[model samples]
Target: MVGFYNSLYNLAHTHLNDTYELLTSLQGRLSPAQTTTLMQSTSWDEIIFVSQRSPRKSSPGLDGLPYEILDILIRVPCFHGLILTSQPVRFGSCYRC
Candidate 1:
């Protein structure tokens, strides 16, 4: 089963070779000011706003934390600070696969 999966994965990966990115490309990019704005630390209000807007019944992610738990977690000051200052986790190009 593993061998079969690996063979199919390799075949699809070779055929795509990142052409998937091209298909999803946006027509334009952010201006320098817009980029800077986006890169700024997210405020707690922004976090709360986004969390509240998320679906209540959504499934938990790989970390097994649901949006409801996340909303609660952000209310803790230390946790909120950690979130604001934390660097995003970088994953390999094929991490999604």
Candidate 2:
């Protein structure tokens, strides 16, 4: 798992660094494995979205979802699938795979 994490870190070094810092400061008390899982499960897009929204406190939130603070728990990568929710756009629906 460390090897896999290392590979992912290499692929998204800066973003992963920011995520690691945030995770360390979290009060939720997630285990190391859980943290890794969260990182691996999340998408780069969601991370950026949350970071951007944090500063704005956008009204009604992005994509009609909950506030940006809750976005962290929405599960990375998963939120991308969720963005197309309640319609023809289910998980992995965009790729038609």
Q: Find the candidate with the highest lDDT and give its number.
A: 1
| Tens digit of per-residue lDDT, candidate 1, span 6-79 | 88878555746466787668558788998999888778788788888989867335555678887876777656
Model 1 stretches with alpha carbons more than 4 Å out: 1-28, 59-64, 87-97
**Model 1, residue 15: displacement in angstroms?**
24
lDDT of 2 at 55: 47
For residue 17, model 2's alpha carbon misses the true position, in angstroms, by 51
The lowest-lDDT stretch of 10 consecutive residues in candidate 2 is 82-91
Name the TM-score of candidate 1.
0.49
Error of 1 at 43 (Å): 0.7
lDDT of 2 by residue, 14-52 (tens): 677787999988877888988898767545566557556
Tell me how candidate 2 scores on lDDT: 0.57
